[model samples]
Target: MTHHTDLLIIGAGILGLSHAYAAAKRGLKVKVFERTATPLGASVRNFGQALVTGQPPGPMLDLARQSRDIWGQWAQLANLQLKRNGSYLFARTEAEEHLLEAFCAGRAEEYGYRVNLLQGAAMNDLYGGQFRHHRAALHGLDDQQLYSREALPALINYLCRELKVEFHFSTLVRDIEPGQLHSTAGSFRGEQIIVCSGHDYQTLLAEQIAELNPQICHLQMLRARPKVDLNLQHALLTGLSCVHYGAFADLPEAAPVQAQILRDVPHLHEHGIHLLISPTPYGELIIGDSHHYGSDPSPFNAEQVDNWMIELAEQTLGCQIQVVERWQGVYGSRGPGPFSFLRAADGVSVALMHTGVGMSVGPAMAERNITELWGEV
Candidate 1:
């Protein structure tokens, strides 16, 4: 069978869905093909936090801001659950605190949101989350989160049912031509095609993107049930996160913070581990993760990494956690870029987020790409 659409999107991950959304909003007939029955890639494998605050300035940050608005629109349109309640980045040391101080004092407002500077233990007093070593905290007011496991599917359904988008799940694209692509399910034709197949660059546009030498960034994610009611309203991150996110990495104070963390925790940078804890509406906690990158990512999920994360979460929250679930999350990374976008032969384009910020920036990127390809409606 042959399917024809105004726009054809490969991969049903966040990027693909975002493209579908942007195209459909332009009144184009859009069809999406996914290798898996559902989006099982970086889209759902993450903490579901938007992390707009973590984006560096320029194009990446601009895209994040635009995507945040789109996410809000989708939440209401699709009746999806979204926690508009921001996020928290805490300092475990004086250096980390100084970084947050300088960041807040300088240009955090340019992020298009308010960032409240909180003293070490003040978070516990206001939000009931106890971080034992907190020196200061940046309460980023714009970051949002969705329980992507549920919200993403709901968004797909809304796209199909309400916006008239078509989706072919479990369809593997075998070949790409000028205006068409052949999939396991059938042949699909579109005026424009977008290949956002997460981490499967070799299968699509190897020549255009392979030279960049992107690797699979392997990560460990966990869901735990806290022993007590923490009443934490905001998503949480630690000093490791401050240094890890590009937003603060450029701050003069960030170098010392990173150095201090490396000196204190020898295993952290070794394993690319950072601490992020967020709550699920159902009362479970989302905790994670450790990073390791390679052409072929490790099949082994380190037990020590999971143990370390749980320990860190416990210390930060001042409560024990019973881990209910665990898994390995993987995404394509090109070392030091936010993402790589390239055009290929025959109206085909490739967009892959090198960082896990795809969920936060994909929609805006899609909108921009679609406009550049076909011009705005």
Candidate 2:
């Protein structure tokens, strides 16, 4: 069978779905193709943290703020559960505390967000005694969270049912040209084509993606089901995250924090380990992650790295967590750039390597890309 649409999107991850939603909302006929039966990529495997507070200043941060707003609107419309649980970057050492103080004092506004610096009694009053041992914490009051496992499907449902966007699943795209895409299901013809395929350098525009020599980042993540019900009010991050996130890294104060981390926790740094613990609506804790980068990262999950992650989480939260699930996620990355965009051909754009911020900035980035491709719509 043959199909036609005003816009054809390849890949059904958040990026592709965002493009479909944006185009369809503008009254363009949109069709999406997914090689898998469902979204099984980084879009579904992430923490689903729509984090704007951690984005570096400038275009990336702007896009994240916009995307966060869009996610809230869609969540209400679709009746999806969106958790507006803020984030806290807590510091354990005096050096880490200095870094947080500097960030809250100087760089917070530059990063285009407000954060409260909590310590001692104030921290205990807000987050309870669990955080009392920590020297200081930066509270980002506007960060949001959603269960990607559920939210992605809800977004797809909303797009299809309300916007009439077409979706073809388990359809492998064999090739893509300027105006048409050849797929296992059928050939699709559209005026514009947007490819949001992540870490899939072999399919579609293999030659172009190869030319870029993009690095693939593999991360190990785990889910812990606490034996007791614990309602967490905020997504907790450790001082390690301050060094990992670009917004904090760009700050001058982050240098000493990074140096301290490298000197003190060299093993954690070796594995790109940072602690992020987010609580799900069901009372389970989703924790992660360690980063290993290469063209092909080892499929073996490092038990040692997982242990380190859990230890850090336990120390920071001061609680015992039972591991219930474990997994790995691989995504495309090009250092420094929040994302990479390639012009495969006229009327065709390839968006990939969104690093760890796909859920944070995907929607607004897609909207901007579509507007750039078609102009003034």
Candidate 3:
């Protein structure tokens, strides 16, 4: 027997789920297949931050904003537990402080980032003097932070119960063509098929994605419990983030900041180490991460990397931290651009986010493609 639907989506990650929402709203029968028993993957293993302020500008930034709007709408519709979080990007060095100043002087405000430079007592009031050694902080007040782990499950519930979309869990797609998919559960046929399997380059679109010189990024992440009642008002970022995010990385002031980091701490630079601390709904702080990239990198994580990150977090927060958990996150490399939609000869399509910003940009990307295929939704 064969299962059928109007649209068949593979990989129930953010991209797939977003596509599902787009189609279902248009009154189309949609079915989604996931290899895992639940929605698990990059969609959950992140800061849950709608990182709108740091996008590289132009198309990518626009998509980030649009996706954020859709996320807000869905949060209300799905009753997702969400928080509107701003970010305090603290500067640890003189060059970094200058870069933050430059970022706030023109581009940040011009781009509607609403960045403000705060220092001394004003900064102290924000986080209760967490950053005693930091020079200054630039706060972007419009960023959105989702309860990443819970949002997916709630979204799944909304799709299944409210939207009437069908989900086939633990169903692996062994083969796929234009309108048919052979899976472990059985055969599925549809008028359209979309692949949003994230970094699974081996399973689908192997030839096409491989041709684009793709690489997988292995990042180290952890959760920690603070020793005291710490008020984490915003997502915490450090000087290193200035060079990591496109919004500030390209600024003239950032060049020296990047160079100074490379010259002073080559190890951090080599491992793509940057510190981001986001507070979970349960009040535990999620900290990370260091990026290691290659076709096939070491499966085992380096202990020293964890130690370095913990030590950095401890220093920045002005408190001791008890590390509760640790894990590695895998995502597709940002090859040439932020994301891509590849078309196969048989009219099938693969949508992949090159960076970990899928949670931030997935919905809008799906809306674009779905609208292109079947008109406005």
Backbone collisions counted per model: 0, 0, 0
lDDT of 1: 0.85
Given candidate 2, what's the lDDT at residue 311? 89
- CA lDDT, candidate 2, residue 128: 50
Report the C-alpha lDDT of model 3 over 1-377, residue by residue, as the tens digit: 68778898999989999999999999999999999999777788888878777777788788988988898899899999767767788898889989888878778768777677987887776665667678898877667787778899899999999999999999998988888989998998898889988888899868887877777898999999989878675788899988888889989999999899889888999989999988887878989999998886467999999999999899888889999999888888857678888776465888888887888788999999999888985
lDDT of 1 by residue, 209-228 (tens): 77777889989999999898
Q: Please give the lDDT score at residue 135 for candidate 1.
A: 70
- Candidate 2: TM-score? 0.97
Give candidate 3 regions above 4 Å deviation: none
Among these predictions, the greatest lDDT belongs to 3
Q: After TM-score superposition, what is the CA distance of residue 95 in candidate 2 from its true location, in Å?
A: 1.1
CA lDDT of every candidate: 0.85, 0.85, 0.86
The residue pairs that clash in candidate 1, if any, are: none
* Count of backbone collisions within predicted model 2: 0
Candidate 2's C-alpha runs over 4 A off are: none
- For model 1 the local lDDT of residue 34 reads 89
Residue pairs in steric clash, candidate 2? none
- Clash count (model 1, backbone only): 0
